[model samples]
Target: MALQIFETDPDARPAPKVKSEYTRPAFTFRSGMQRNRKPVKLDNWRIVAEELEPLKALAELLGGTAEEYSASAREPFHVLTETDSVEIVIDGAGAVEERMILWGPNGPIHECDGVEFLSPADAKGKPCGCPKELDQRKAWAQQGRGPKPNIPIRFRLAGLGYELGFGLLRISAWTFLPDLDPLKAALAAIDGEALCTLELEHISFINDKGEKIEYSKPKITVQGAYADAIAEER
Candidate 1:
C-alpha cells in the first residue's frame, strides 16, 4: 500500500519485513534494476533536513539518545520532472520540531542524513560544478566502508548522468533483527537532523541501443539523511 503523505492520514507504510539488510529496499542502481534489460529507470528522490540533536551536543557529540522519527517523501510521481515535490517528518530534542514539505523539480525526496553536498548551491564554495562534487564523493565511498551504498541512482534517460542521493544508517549493514528492527532503525533514535537537500550529479546506465550511457553533469537534488546524529554535544 502507498504510504499517505499527509498527517491527517496517520498511515504508516507497513514495514517490509527485514528479510535482508536493506529492509526499506529503496532504489539502488546496482541490484534488481535490469540495467541490461531496460534502458532507464526513474527514481524519485526527496530531501528534508532536521536538526534534533542540539541539546545532546550542548556539551558533547550528543547527550543520551534522542528518539526522533522522520521520513522522506515524494509526490505520487510516475516520473521525476523539471520540477519536484515532497515532504519531511522531524522530532528534535523532544522539543523544537516541525515539518516543511516542498514542491519543485529540485527539492528533497528522501530522509538523507549526512554532510552530503546537497545541491549546486552546496558546491558553491568549491571549484567546478556538481560533477566534481560527485566524483570526489564516489571515490570517497570506495574506501571499503563495509556495506556499499546504492550507488549510481538513475531517475531518467537524460543520458550520461542522472541525479544522485544516498541514505546513511549509522548501524552496520550486518545489524538486522527479525521483527521491526529495520523499521525501528530507519525511524529510530534520530537526534541529528536529516538533510533532504538537492543536487545534480552523474550516474551510469545503458541507452535504448544497449550501450553504456554516462549521465554527465545534470542538476539532480539528492535530499537524504545520515542515519546518525550530529548534535551540538551535551
Candidate 2:
C-alpha cells in the first residue's frame, strides 16, 4: 500500500508583513562652530584615528579576503565613526570612489553585501588593536593600502555623513570609550547624562551580482536623537 498522509482540516491565511523599525536614518551634519545655538552637531563628529584602521581588520574578520591587496573596495555604502564613536563617514569619499548608498528615510532595505552581524557579547570579547591582524591581512596586497584610514571621514555640512566602499564591509554594535567627544555630546543631550541607553543603528547594502537593480532600494530612519542633534547643532 502507498504511504498515506493526512492533513488536519485547516485553512491557510496570508501572514501580514511586519516591518522592522531599526534603520539608519538620514540627516545632515553641520559644523558646530558656525551654528551658534548649541555646540555643533558636527562637533560630535570627529575621527578616531587608531580605532578605524582596526575596523578594517575586523571587516576582514567578518568577510573580505585573507590576503591584502591594493584593492580599494569594501562595501557599496558604509557609515563608520571614529572607534571613539565621534566622527562618522556615511557614503563615500576617501578609499571609496564610486558612490552607491541610497538616500532618504524609508527609502529601501537591502540585505548586506557579503556582510555578517555579531551579537554584542561576541563583539566585546575581541582582542584590541589590529596591527598584527592588519599586517597579516594586508601583507599580500599588491595595490597597496588604499589611504590610511582618515580622521573625520566626511561631514555632509547640511546633510548626513557618508563613507562609501567598493565592496561589502561594515562593523555594527561595538561600544566606544568616554573619551569620544561626539558621542559624549549626543548622549548628554539625548539622555541628560544619566548613563542612559543609546542605539547605534547599523545597516548593510548587498548587490550580490548587480542583478537586482530594481529591488536594490536603500532605507534610512534618522529621527529622535539623530534628528534632534542635527536640529540643535544648526
User: Who wins the lDDT comparison?
Assistant: 1
Please give each candidate's TM-score: 0.19, 0.19
Candidate 2 CA-lDDT value: 0.27
Candidate 2, residue 32: how far the Cα is off, in Å: 25
lDDT of 2 by residue, 1-234 (tens): 753333342244345788853223222111222223453333122211112343343333333322322234331222233321222223322311111111124542211111221113454334322233434423322233211221222222212123421122121101221123443343334432111121223334458775532211111222334454555888
RMSD of each: 21.9, 20.0
Each candidate's lDDT (Cα)?
Answer: 0.28, 0.27
Distance from true location, Cα of 104 in model 2, Å: 27
Tell me the tens digit of each residue's lDDT in model 1 across 18-94: 66422221221111122345745334222221332222221121122322223332311111222222222222222
Give the TM-score (vs. native) of candidate 2. Answer: 0.19
